[model samples]
Target: MADNYKQYTSCCQAKDWVSLSAYLGFAAAGLAVVWIPIIALAGWCALFYLLVAAAAAGVAACRWWLEVRLVCLGGDRSAIGMLVSSEPPADKSWPGSVDSDFSMNLLPYPALPGIKQADLELTSPYGFLVAEQAGTKQHVGFFTGEKATEKNGVESAILHAEFEGAGVRDVLIAVTVALGLAIAALIACVAIPPPWGLIVAGILALLAFLAALFGTLFGSGDHGAPGDVKGAPTEVHDNDPVTGLGADLLYVYGTWVFDSLHTGWNEIHPIKKCTFVGKWEGAWPADIVDVQHRLDAGFADARDPATVSRQAEDRFTWAIHPLVDGCGEAVDVPAPAQADAGLH
Candidate 1:
């Protein structure tokens, strides 16, 4: 897994260089368009200022897209979680390459279950786990499990990492190209000295400038916090507990909430959403069972007005209390009920 991750990291670094080179090429080409005119009309000092401003804008735009927007909006609500059926292999095969199943749902998409027995070698066993969507064969989020020594009779696994989507790279490339073309057009106007050419170049430059400015300001989403997406670690929790049925169990899970849903400047009232990832078995937690019961009761009493009202009240209280008080812990288990005094 470590080797595989290292390889992937190398690949990403290479890809970054490729992207940087492409952007630089575009910037150079754009500068060539206006180089002659800027030197002839504006003199050396003006030309220098123009070059510096363009470079600064280009750098700022790149950083804004890669570091800010991509980090925040790239996969804010997407994650990978694994549930291993049994202990992993002893050999140094893939760490999380045990007999396991992966399930994931990248917001606005339904939950997808991966194939039970697929080619593991073709898949990423470490770093980011990629699973083929059941029928479509499209790769979804990363998920994997690894062997772990029992700590106080409890076994656990943790996985959290950032992934860049194709969209981020595509947008960056488009902006770079646009800026380049705008410069080229302006140079053509200066060299040719045609009214039509100048008009066209001016339009193109304005459009490109607007695009860069807008993307930098509102590309990611509203309320995009730099620290939130800048290599921030995902939160995870796990523990071992004994159920009333005498079944020992180990559970692991995590949750993530997006900082903002707004994807554009005009967007308002963005849909707020969160994702939950975990693995559990046998008897579920008491709180989960209780919530299910309450929801079911609410459905059953839907025909009665008074019962419906009471159920709504209970549900609201249960749901809002955690939000109001701030749920510091991952999972909260209600205390066990006491037995009746005369029952025994």
Candidate 2:
């Protein structure tokens, strides 16, 4: 089971780049429609088909933009809790492959689904871990987890990240447009004559609509669920004695809310949402620097802590809380192999 989860993690990490590729493809498909006529004149009506194709692609681009923006503005990662570890846990057994202090052994580049690299440390009976995510220009937070319900003693987790302001509206509008187009195509096919063009258009629009729906439904709670918090650590209580390691880690299974639902539609969930979970480790004031700088110059500031602390509360207290009651130690993401590694 552990191996299975690690496999899933590795696949998920690689899929980030795959998603980027898919988004670019979507954008390209949209542009292709403009050239459909030239191709059609040569032999086929490729230009007309391309125009329809482009609309679908435009929908995809809009969706990708929504996800990336949210991650940058509101996404975060942290060590939620420990998985089941009995014998001596090997570093290689986990999902992320880390080697040196800065570089990783397996996949080198950061994936697009928000999280970048994971820092795993074995602290006595429990594993102390931290996962550094992709976005840095915005804010960060921690989520929590629940006990295993499968009876295998496995840990279950979830994550909540919010997208705010006009950006959210943009994504919602795109989704509505895509769905509208698909519906139009469907009606045209059913009410009008039977033709390959209409059928193809309907199918493409439907596929795009489903993708958008999956992204949104995957991370949402039932109606009337409470809001969550962001970037707190794993929480554990000594008074509540456990037979073994308690579940305090939160692994974000998938995102529930995407940007499109609230964009042009004037739509927002009834509740303000964010990801919340239990503690993975204790919290302390972590001194943060400009992620753009890669040098070891340990220039630390005093005021930044207070500022970040307040920012943390105001932005995320409703949605999430670190498993640990307080803040964690200051940990820096090392410079990447690319020249702008620190900037990310």
Query: Residue by residue across 1-344, what tens digits does model 2's lDDT show?
Result: 00000100111121232244556675676555754544545333333333345455545654554444222212222222222221111222221111000100111011111122221212211122122233221122222211122123332221222122232233345455655665455445444455775676567567756645543342121111111123322222211123432423222221222122122110111112212233323231122111212111111221256655765653346444443443443458788676675675
lDDT of 1 at 315: 38
Please, what are the lDDT tens digits per residue for candidate 1 over residues 235-313? 3223243421222222111222111112211000111111232234433343543433443344335436776576455
Count of residue pairs whose backbone atoms collide, per candidate: 2, 52
lDDT of 1: 0.33
Candidate 1: 10-residue stretch with minimal lDDT: 1-10
- Name model 2 segments beyond 4 Å from true: 1-16, 19-22, 26-54, 65-344
lDDT of 1 at 55: 40
